[model samples]
Target: MGDKTDPNTTKIIHPVYIVANIQNKVRILDGKKVTYSSWVKLFKLHACGYKVLSHIDGTTPPAKTDEDYESWSEIDAIVLQWIYGTLSDDLLTRVLEPDSIAYEAWTRIQNIFLNNKGSRAADLEHEFNNLTLRAMPSLEDYC
Candidate 1:
């Protein structure tokens, strides 16, 4: 679907509209503590390929035609590769054991990082309560 021909070469050139091969090495997630910063980096990495996790997870159905299916499968494979390559070894084991669709695997990763357990919630609450605004010479400095 993403091919072009140059007048000089008559050979098909695949446009790098989606993820570039070089970008495939963006950043590997360590899976120690899932933070928004890392999640955003990973999200942008996939977004560059137009491989939105929601769509891949079947929030939208697969195309009905064989050709469409082939295209979808190719994209899915790219996503699968990126996902597998980025996760840490421990996270990889968790992700692999489920034997799930790409979307589900992605979701599992998100859940591992994003889920707010009671302990975490309480810790945040404690931190919030203990926070204090230091005196500042100016309003701008306080801000």
Candidate 2:
């Protein structure tokens, strides 16, 4: 019988690698809707829940010589698939690229939303209109 302490036979597993039902948990991210931030928030939360946040947190990959590189890349690809599955056809086409890892894909999607001046302006306006004089420490601070 094989012993439990055999490192060669042991395969370390992560939650993200286990396929789960995501129909209700992850909805399509509509770039045209006000739900952009909401969609991104939920996506990040999903990744966080499975402890694969690092794959999508914009961190550089480990060197090929590093012992963790292979495992890191495996998880990165899984995370990348998660990102791809949630995007709509239009967004998927826009963000998809050959051999892109999770971090690269995350940055692409983030830049697309963050650089939207219209959405940014609207969010700013909404916040500004609701700002109170007492919201800040002082009148000058509020202004």
Judging by lDDT against the true structure, name the best candidate: 2
**lDDT values of the candidates?**
0.61, 0.82
Error of 2 at 37 (Å): 0.8
Q: What is candidate 2's lDDT per residue for 36-104, written digit by digit as tens?
A: 788878887887888987888766779999999998989888888888888888889989999888889
Question: Which regions of candidate 2 fall more than 4 Å away from where they truly are?
Answer: 1-12, 32-34, 119-143
- On a 0 to 100 scale, what is the lDDT of residue 138 in model 1? 69
Per-model TM-score on C-alpha atoms: 0.56, 0.71
**TM match of model 1 to true structure:** 0.56
